[model samples]
Target chain A: MNKQSLVYTVIFTFIVSFVFVTLLALANDGTKERVQLNQELNRQRAILNALNIDYNGPQDVQDKFQNVEQIERDGVTLYRTTVDGETIYAKEFTGSGLWGLIRGYLAVTANMDRTIGIEILSHNETPGLGGRIDEPWFKQQLRNEKIVDGTIRVDGAGDGDTNHDNGQIDAITGASRTSDAMRTILSRELSTFQQILGGNS
Target chain B: MSSPGQILKENLWTNNPIFMQVLGICSALAVTNLLTNTMIMTIGVTFVTAMSNLTVSLLKGLIPRKVRMIVQTLIIAFYVIIVDILLRAYLPDISRALGPYVGLIITNCIIMGRAEAFAQSNPPLISMWDGATSGFGYMAVLLVIAFFRELLGFGTLFGIQVLPDAFVPWTIMVTAPSAFFFLGIIIWIGKSIMNREGAPA
Candidate 1:
């Protein structure tokens, strides 16, 4: 039982790990369902955000989300909400970012020519650089931008077109890779979004 | 063995992890933008630090010298995950706002530092007391910083309107840069007081 012995080290390490890990495993299991519900509620909040729905808190998020109808068309899941008689469709989208995967919801008008809004659900980009995608101004810029076949471009302000009136939304400064990734995610998802609504409607 | 009163004073003031040891600064800067968030975040840190220190102290004699670091890490991570899961379930909004910082608590040096310096040599109860007080030390500074940041940045205290109508929010205070000024000032004031006390023990 010498503490310095290699065998003791191995046994002691195993025992210590087992004790702490078992505690963690129990905690994880106990809260697994509640955590998943919270995560789902977060996605629900993002959907509401994309649709420009105002919610005061998690309770309101739950209540407001009640009006949202989940629809699956051709394997595409869309969150449907009617706001002031206009039908907005929100669908989850994912793409590669500079550091890791980017996940979010993209809401659009039924016609799919303009985005209602976009809410980044998760990302792994560097903080203050690509991570600015989650900033209010950055995401706010995506609101009501015209898009056809998801052809929206996220490039430099004056690279090709500076006009946000068109489908060109300004990319984040110093985050070209992440911006390009956003473009790829939206353009690809939007076209498919168009199809999802186009077929269902 | 240190008296409980001395441990509390040292951790809360003289030997504070944040002020004296200068540990756990990253979270101090990141979460202090809002008082409510800072409170919850620091409380979580406190709980994890206390429990981890207790467990580490209790198992110190049984732990292998060669694998002690790994054991301490497992112990800390276990408590952090429990705190994270609890937050996700109970305070989902704050949990989302705090985001990766909660999980990042596992990397906070204060926990490991306590486990190594105090917990390894101290009895379980005192180790836990030292750990908790250290967290309070960290919390006291962060709360002060957060109070100013939230007040000036948003004209609010704990999300309530505190400033008068004429008050104009300082936009810079809400950003990351604001934390530096507050942290530097706090550190300067703390060190000055310590210097006036005449000598480092």
Candidate 2:
């Protein structure tokens, strides 16, 4: 192809491709708000689930979680709350796991030392193993655990016994690394939450 | 002229992407732990691939020979973004389960490979058919893998228990690496079947 023809082809291709992509973006604009709302609602649901609070859908979610207030620190969103008699604060934390990042919410009781519950908001672990952490059976073990001493461990199977020396949650079988990563992340996040909620408490 | 039945046989089974060509293995490995995630991921890939193929083929005549690949990539990325946005809005849970893997579909070799090899040379309608059919082929393999994965890994399929109380679950079947093994086994079985049919190159 000649230089002039090649230039024309390039220009034409650029224009067409640009126009097509722009149109797609424009079409997506209509659904963007719904997407944002869905994401926010899903996050609220996960946090509520971590706290053992359940609602069917969006309207149910709104009815139960009517009051949401932001907790800011140094211009950053440290945590947020939904007031439903008991104030539940959702704190975010991230850490390196066996494969990739493990990000989650650790919801605390009003006193801050007791864990209301925990939920994995995002993770990149091996599926079927680390991914099992997303299951409720694994998460439910966190409820009512004292965050001050709660330590996640993988040891030989024992009777479901509570040891107060450290808050103990039965680790998921075959997902030791991922469970350990969660423990490390939650401990670190709870300490920070304590610092943030210290004055108020 | 080749009949539609012949083409369907070729695309759907004889030359299946996941079982035979082994394209798009990333999603197969990542999302097959749960039947629901596997289903949604299949639909998302089908939408992105078909739309990308259609757009690419439509512009093939106008695309510069030198920059055809770049143009194809732009078209594919546009479709992927559209699918990603829609999933985030409508299927928040599955989207969250998919994580960055949905956006990573932009780099899914199946979409790109189809555009460069088939879509760029075919008419838009044919390319769309090819993309959708190839996605089905891909889903066929993933579902087979997921069937076993969800069954042995969780003692269930689609969260419904199929195993009697005596059957112990296999933990390894649910992880991403297990998909590698499953894909290998599926490919081996497929190759053997093709070889019995005179090994058409």
How large is the i-RMS for each model, in angstroms?
A: 3.2, 2.5
Candidate 2 Cα outliers beyond 4 Å, as residue runs: A1-4, A67-90, A94-96, A111-113, A146-166, A189-201, B164-167, B198-201
Model 2 share of native interface contacts: 0.64
What is candidate 1's lDDT per residue for B38-94, written digit by digit as tens? 999999999999999999999898887888889899989988988988888888888
Sequence-dependent TM-score of model 1:
0.78
Q: Candidate 1: lDDT of B4?
A: 98
lDDT of 1: 0.86
Tens digits of lDDT, candidate 2, A135-165: 7766766676665443344343322325532
Isolated chain B TM-score per model: 0.97, 0.92
- Please write out the lDDT profile of model 1 over residues A1-201, one tens digit for every residue: 578999888877787678777877888898889888888888889999998899997899999999999988798788988888888899888899999989989898897778888899888886556777887878877788888445787767422343447887778766788888888888788778866777655
- Report the Cα lDDT for candidate 2: 0.75
Q: What is the lDDT for A142 in model 1? A: 73
